[model samples]
Target: MPGLTFEKLLLIAIIAVFVLGPEKLPHYAAQLARLVKSLKNMASGAKDRLRDEMGPEFNDVDWQKLDPRQYDPRRIIREALLDDEGAAAPVAVKPPTRSRPVESAAQKRLGLAEAGAAAPFDSEAT
Candidate 1:
């Protein structure tokens, strides 16, 4: 049913008539119809059994809300990380501040300054 439109069904029927021939086609077609009907009945019977086992809870359940297809990974993670009231708490951001560079003795010996500018070099030190 998903991919089979009326035109596609007609084309398949035409091909089947040639391949199976008119006499055997009817028999196969009837078998196919029975198979589809049985499958539908099986699915409905399963639902009915589940409903009977669950009682009133089955009817009360929100099927759409419980559907796996409706879930989003990002949204689920976000909701889990949210506060108790369901609203997302505002995040406090610290303002960017200029931090003083820590210059080690080795860096100073190498003539590297705090601001990354090269210190005055003595030719003899090399």
Candidate 2:
């Protein structure tokens, strides 16, 4: 029912008319109808076969109960953050990193300040 529309039927008819010509178009159209019917019957048969194979377990499936669009990221993140904050155990707090010692002007001027020290001033006189 979903796929059966007037436009689609018209398109199929046009294609059939083109490929089968006006003379044999009726025969080919009949064959096409029979093929479509057989396909539908095969699909229905497969569904019934699958249900039978699944046995009594098939009845337990609640297809309408699942709604995949219910996920909420904000709620999940809020709950996780709250849970971490509310934990009873005292978490080890990392000590504030010792502030990097400021280099004196003398040390900065001299290249011997540190092994990886960058030359602060550009000196083109080599």
Candidate 2: Cα lDDT at 117 = 73
Point out where model 1 deviates above 4 Å. 78-126
Lowest summed-lDDT stretch of 10 residues in model 2? 111-120
TM-score, structure 2 vs. true? 0.42
**TM-scores vs. true structure, each candidate:** 0.55, 0.42
Best by lDDT: 1
For residues 1-126, write the lDDT of model 1, one tens digit per residue.
577799998999999999999999989999999999999999999999999999999999988998998999999887777745766567899966657877779778876756767667789988
Q: After superposition, how far is residue 91 of candidate 2 from its true place, in Å?
A: 16
Against the hidden true structure, what lDDT does model 2 obtain? 0.80
In terms of lDDT, model 1 sits at: 0.87
Off by over 4 Å in 2: 1-5, 64-126
